[model samples]
Target: MDIDWPLLTGLIGLCGVGLLLAYSASGGDARALHSQGARILISLLLLGVASQVPAPWLHRLAAPAYLLTVLLLVLVEAIGAIGQGAQRWLELGPLRFQPSELAKLAVPMMVARYLSDRPLPPTLRDVAASAALALLPVVLIAAQPDLGTALLVTAAGMSVLFLAGLGWRLIGLFGALAAATAPLLWFYGMRDYQRQRVLTLFDPERDPLGSGYHIIQSKIAIGSGGFYGKGWLEGTQTRLHFLPESATDFVFAVFGEEFGLLGAIGLLLLYGFIIGRAMHIASQASDGYGRLLGGGLVCTFFVYVLVNIGMVSGILPVVGVPLPLVSYGGTSMVTLMLGFGMLMSIRGHRKLWPA
Candidate 1:
């Protein structure tokens, strides 16, 4: 099968940069660097395996995958492991995993499958059903109090709806409805800490040592890094432990602290190339399933980049969103690579099927 050379090249570059950033963030800790390296290797292997799987196989599995993930999310609520004050994972025997991560891919696939051949500008009923399909897991995940993952999953589902030709009038209507529900959601749905985050975005200094600490520190780290940065492993905020989650959620701040504005822009450009290539592949897909799935995945990937950067730069609330592959998270890296692999499968399968 033909390979997507540009996408692969962009991934390699990002992976390299991720390694460097992780190593520096860990303060020359070889163990952390090695662990990240191992995950990247595994992620690359999965990407290859996913790329090899035929689109027909993925299409057939879409519904089952979505159902299984929903079940797992329920299971998480029932018997999931708790970490960082949230019950978002299940531990069975020696294995522990986050079911919400599964929804990131499953929700999009199922949405695309449901909407693939549906009439364009779907009726109100169809839109509601699709929203239910997407938001069902979102509700379960929000119960996990993992608002970040829930938002990401919703974004992935919405990407499919948008690509499937959901009309602007309906989109505007939904937006208005969501806006109307914002207050109810804030008071009844969002956790106290989540609300604090929203509030903290406006004035992080209001609680500089409390709910706002993360944004405050993150901003300091980013701002402290001038044009070329403070140089690798020399970021005072990170090395001194002033920055929280330096290896994960705030890795961008660590990167910005060490590499400066130029490095940050370069990283954004790299992500831009990756997203562009994925969307291009999506456009070239041979079938509706392939096109919608590819496009949904690309759009979801874009959300990850946007939210993470926005949060770190203090323009948006901190929602525990990681900086895509660059952040030190195995689950996210693997999930992202799996999406890329599926994109490759969609692109490569097109020539043979030509449907």
Candidate 2:
């Protein structure tokens, strides 16, 4: 059977743009550009391999894979490298990996597998059971203080349970409880610097040279791009080093400053197509498992795009979300490819097995 070329092509196109933007964003740092080129090649190779794997195999491995990631997360906390006030990465000689990215796929896979044939309109017992499965990793990651990824992973897992028929009354109750507890989570749950990030989202002018500077400068860079950007590598905000996190969390600002609104909108449109196609695949899947797995993966993919762009453009508070395949990181690329692989796995094997 022929693979769905559009989804594959769309992902490749997004990554290609990411490489170009990464190059321009880095101010001709030859090392970064060369490294990005190599990473892209590796990512493509992984994508190809993942595309051929079976969904059942992926489902089978979910529990073990997720447990491994959790163990690594806990291990990282115990003896991980500390950077920027958080222990989020595990050093691999020349590489730094984040287990949280792996959790993005693992958590959803485990949940989809769990709820595959459970009764619709879940019982409180099911909801409680599912919540336990979902929150274990969330609590661990949050302890690393990577709130951005922790939240995204939670959303992905909850999406599956929602598909499994989590009660709306329960959802609303959750919403209210989350809102009420947000204050305590804010004042006590968040570190001082994290609290600063939320405050920076509002009045960036308060600390023009501190936590607020990143957002303020990002806005300036995006605004300066206007209709036709400053031209690749010519972005003053990034090339001149005004925009912090230019190559990572704030990568979107660099893209806008160099590629302009047209480029920005074009990028958004590409994401729209990729996500739309994933949703289409989910809808067409043969069974409850296939459908929930595909749909939940789609939501996870969309969150990667949304959080990166939103945080960079100042729409959402700054979160350390990478731009899926675009951002520079091993774990993000691996997790993203795994998600795409699941999509491919679902599409590739559906014809052979009965739902």
Candidate 3:
């Protein structure tokens, strides 16, 4: 099978930059650097294997796989391990996993399967039902209080719905309703920390040294990076432990501290290339399932980039969103690579059978 070199090249480029940023962010710490290196190597292998799986296989397994993912999520809640104040993972002997990662794949499968070739302009009922289906996993995820991942999964589902020709008036009305509900959700539905994030976002100096510290320091770090940065390992904000989650959610701040605007712009361009290739592959898909899966994955990936930069820049409240390909997490990497692999498989084997 022919490989789409552009996708592979883009992935490689991202992994390469991720490694450098990870290493530098750790202030030259050997263990963190090596651990990140190991993740990159493993991700490369996963990407290769994922690229090899035939699209037909993914299509056939779509329903069962989605059901399996839901079951896994249930199992996680029932008898799962807890970490960082959230019961969002399952612990095996040597493998701990987040089932929500599974939703990234499953949600797209279900949506694509539902909307594929139904009709160009879906009725109001169809749209409402699809919206409900999209929100199901999103609500389950927010219960974990992992707002970042939930938002990305929501984007994945919405991409499919949007591709199904959702009308603008409905979207506008939904936005208006969301705006109307924001207050009620804040008072009745949100947790204390979540609300404080929004409050702190508006005026971080209110509690400049406590809960607000992260956003303030992150902004400081990005500005500290200046036009050319402090020359890599010379960043004071990260090395001093001022920015929270420096290895993960706040990696972009560290990235800014070391790379400056030029590097930041370069990183954005890389993301653009990755998303562009994903869309190109989605366009090449031979079936509706492939189209939905491929398109949904690319859109989800775009959400990661946008959310991370937005939160870090203080335009949006901090929401635990990790900068894609740069954050230090095995689960996020695995899920992302899995998506790319499926995209590659769809592109490579678009024809030649039950696709």
TM-score of every candidate relative to the true structure: 0.98, 0.95, 0.95
Off by over 4 Å in 3: 353-355
Alpha-carbon error at 125 in model 3, in Å? 2.5
lDDT at residue 33 of model 1 (Cα atoms): 89
- For model 1, residues 168-262, the per-residue Cα lDDT tens digits are 99999999999999999989988788888999999999999999899899999999999999999999999899999998999999989899999
**CA lDDT, candidate 2, residue 31:** 81
**Ten contiguous residues minimizing lDDT sum, candidate 1:** 116-125
Per-residue lDDT of candidate 2, residues 71-106 (tens digit): 998888888888988898899899787877788888
lDDT of 1: 0.90
- lDDT tens digits, residues 197-281, model 3? 9889899889999878988999999999998888778789988888888888888888888889888888889999989988989
- Top TM-score model: 1
The most accurate candidate by lDDT is: 1
Colliding residue pairs in candidate 2: none
The superposed Cα distance between candidate 3 and the true structure at residue 28, in angstroms, equals 1.2
In candidate 1, position 199 carries an lDDT of: 91
Model 2 misplaced stretches (Cα beyond 4 Å): 91-96
Ranking by TM-score: 1, 3, 2
